[model samples]
Target chain A: MMRIEDILMTLRMFQDENCDVRTVTLGINLMDCADSDLATTCRKLQEKIRRLAGDLVQEGTLVAEEYGIPIVNFRLAITPVAWWAADYGVDGLVRVARALDQVAQEVGVDFVGGFSARVEKGATRADNALIAAIPEALASTERVCGSVNVASTRAGINMDALLAVSRSILDLARRTADTDGFGCAKLVVFANMPDDNPFMAGAVHGGGEPECVINVGVSGPGVVKRAVERLRAGSPDLNLGDLAEEIKCTAYRVTRIGELIGTALAQRLRVPFGIVDLSLAPTPRIGDSVGEILQMMGIGRVGAAGSTAALALLTDAVKKGGAFASSSVGGLSGAFIPVSEDAVLAEAAARGDLPVDKLEAMTSICSVGLDMVCIPGDTSAETLAGVMADECAIGVMNHKTTACRLIPVPGKGPGERAVFGGLFGEAPVQPVRSGGEDFIRFGGRIPAPIHGLRN
Target chain B: MSDNSQDFIIAVMAKDRPGIIAAITQTVFELGGNVTELSQTVMGGYFTLILRATLPAERKESVIKQHLEEDWPDLALAACVRRYSPERLFEPELDTAAYFLTIQGEDRPGLIALITRYLAERQINIEDLYTRTEGDAITLILQIHPQNRQSAEHLRADLQNFGERQGIAIHLLHRDILRATSEVGAIRRMVRQGGCLS
Candidate 1:
């Protein structure tokens, strides 16, 4: 005879799948917060962020408790600051970043990103200044995060910007080598950057977002992974469809928890509710990799046969479950393959089995593109330009968000390993196969592909 | 020609062209061999193929290798004759796990080897990986499973410290790949004109 508790437990097994909350990102719009005077700009930026985000941490905690979910991190994503700092130059930009940091501390957010610019096709003087200031800005400010968009599906990749950004990342690291380029931790060079992403360093209030909206990022890679393991243990005969069904069910529960937390947080914060991003955002830990999930599906390696199909299934299942959970589900709601953020992915990178090209291929199906990859220090800027071009083409052609967060480790090459501590794992600094400086000298915007002009 | 217990495994790499499959399959058929398993892929203009076949008792691995190499010099062929593992013939248990890992750093060679060697030593298995390059910057992913029952978070922190010294960002976490099917039961009851599962 089964006790009532046992029966209920069996029926409620899915509830455990929904235990994680993806992100509690506080959105701060910086467009109206800047001033001509550097001091005024900094003060305004600080006041605005502090005023808006002051209650964010407490509210997020209350909501997490109410929904019985773990809100992993409290973060802030502001409007891209490059545009506002166009007239102020690097010095002025640094001051704004300092103010941003102060506000982040006051609000108790883990990270405050959005010192960014959208330049998928080309860049202006302002964009250049911001990109140039990356190393210093990140080193100078503890919380200010920066991301520069050098590629987009419609406009292709800006080779010039990519080359420059690559150099900027390297310079930033070298300047702060002692800090493990922790400043680089605050930077993400993107293509097809999302507007509603609630994950920091990359999260920014998209152009399409509401002025003040509360969004959520839900994570449950552990829940789905456990279900797969259980299914395989219980029944060897289960097919791929059976596996997919389990994934969807797990995702549904996880999505519901995220919605519950987000809704509760918004109500308490007295802000308009926004989308819930159901991204399998992983931390620097084992057993939490999206790539490991694909491996579990029987593919010998990450880039091998049936990889895309598996990713598509996972992405779709997550979206389906999340959509059903909330009417306002939006943002990059899919499995994330950020390399530096997942330990399993980092290990595969250290092995020869995974390559940068394979990572690019997987991005076609995953939510984001080739991210947190390392290359040889001597790699010519042109090679970086080419990679950016290829990734941007994928995003524009497929009409999806793609990004590149490449690190040019000083004094390293293919086959040599570098270990970046804490959340950023170890990586094999893959050497570039190409090294043509001539291509980068072309220096003109690649015309937006005809497809982008389409509706 | 009456060998019932002999089998041959063929591994071939060649430039992809027309009739490659037909040529191989036809060769086996004409030679009175039964093709049991086959897998092929075309990448970077080269075609890679693997085949498992049962051959007549009189045939040997050397004979097949000799004949194939002599007949088709254009096709780089390698053959090994051995007893087949029955487990390889059937799908293994469908157990699956998913995870994410992050590694950041100054560029170096053999970083993958260093990390994977650790996993291999600990009985952890790697599945898939994704990496991107912008100039010298690199970020990569490795999906893996641990054979031991250690805490995933503990492993991640250790790797993180390792990465910090080398300038690599390391983050590892497991992915939940499936959910329980309680809701499916509700659907079954609602559609009870002989439910879909039944």
Candidate 2:
């Protein structure tokens, strides 16, 4: 029998602490739908996705209701389009992207990932075409998200692909200039991308996955922050180790909820259950910031002197707790500090306390790199590629997943606010330090580090 | 008196005292009874317990009652005894999911009736219910199982609307989540075993 106190505590976490399942993504493999004719392939792809994920939103709602936990987003992820659609050029890819957007709308999903290319080692003809089509594809579709994997520990960083992605992101920004470069928000450049991440704009159903599976992303930074606060109030003399233990315990509970809900949903859908991504992904809500979790850990402000240490402690503890809670823990299971998505981080950026470099430095220890960051509109494509290269280098060297969803709002300069609204939130454009043009101009692959030569 | 052993359902009620369990168990033991299951709780100034015990078929229910009343007269304990049938030994497995519903509002009459009536009308079973009153505020906690066919979303919406009308705050959550948060080890074990806890 569950104790009354325990029931009340869980209820309070949901009602007051903002504990929620961030997403329930249905990953559908579109590889089998490929055809020599682009139109036929797009049609087959839509039909397959519609058939497999038609009930996704409804089932997700039912599961969320059954658990009394809010599932904020119901999303879809398919296999990377580039590999199977090698014959399709930019125009054909755009058509496929539109079909994906339509299917997402018909199925009532928030976003459809896997309008993607994996060019970590090198770009194939198809990968090159897909990379070129990203700006138009994303700008033309509301729900289609694009990702490009340009680096991996084993394969080294593809600087050539990075340059293309950077230029494409700028084009996407220009195309959606009216929405404060919102099109760029739907695109992510990744390094060592996970096969089972359920979070967007970087989620993709990798080739190794089953035909269809359900992966859940659980988020509860507010709960962790509150737990720390309560622990501190009760035992003021507790050290950092004690506090880290508390965070781990909180993460365990959070991940358990995700697993429970995900299992039930998968069983109902009669699809294979993938993994629960135990990422502390925050929204624009006031109390739901990863930066706040750091603050509760004794940082006076986010981006302070000890922020990286705090983030490292937090990410490590979260992963430890998640690993203990579930056997199939995958994806980027750590804290996400997306600037515009987190109010505190956005505030720190606005106040000039958190610069682009500090945010990049923190990502070395946290989850995902340079997420939801807004840079000045005039930032050059080479500079953008430089940013991507630097962040990708961190991922390659550390053997971790890193991504960039940098938005360069058109006509918006540093100190100006770019509002994407909703979960994308709003943030002041951070100034980018230039002078990396020469480095990015040398557009060739950076060979994999010696550490990657394990085999 | 028969050759087969008999099961007795026993209830004990008394003012809260430390030796009540010892005295009761000792008497049962003396009667050649083996305790099978027992649950006890204290409310207000009184203690209550229910137990299932098996005794030799030669003993009668009245014999145990009379012995308890006569031997523990000074303690002023009340004992009720009944025959426990085999059919009642095993509880049916509950396959449906469990949820915890919490309600809080200003203390008022008919609050419990209103909530219970709503659930009863919908065929939602309340597995365990508890309520406490402090000054003008009343809090209720209920473990509920939605009927197999009932839609949880519909029920949640109805309950939320009802709460709005009645000026009460209601929160509903999965029972497993509560178990996971409060007793992490129990949830871990359940997950590892690939089973749901009742």
Model 2: which residue pairs collide? none
Model 2 off-target regions past 4 Å? B1-3, B86-95, B117-125, B132-135, B146-148, B151-157, B182-198
Error of 2 at A29 (Å): 1.1
Report, for every candidate in turn, its global Cα lDDT versus the true structure.
0.70, 0.88
Write the residue-wise lDDT of candidate 2 on B153-179 in tens digits.
Answer: 567778788889999999887766776
Per-residue lDDT of A308 in model 1: 76
Write candidate 1's Cα lDDT for A80-189 as tens digits: 88878787787777777778888888889878888898887778888888888787888888777888887776787777787788778878867766644446656887
> Which prediction has the highest TM-score against the true structure?
2
- Model 1: per-residue Cα lDDT over B9-45, one tens digit each: 8876678887677777777776788888998877769
lDDT for model 2, please.
0.88
Query: How well is each residue in A1-455 modelled by candidate 2, as lDDT tens digits?
Result: 57766676688778899999999999999888889998899899989988999898888887677668899999998999997888889999999999999999999998999999999999999999999999999999999998999999999999999998888999999999999999999998999999999999998999799999999999999999999999999996899999889999989989988888887788778898899999999999988989888888988788889999999999999999999988978989999989999999999999888999999999998989999999988889999999989999999999899999999989999999999899889999999999989988888999998899988
**By summed lDDT, which 10 consecutive residues of candidate 2 chain A come out lowest?**
A1-10
Best by lDDT: 2
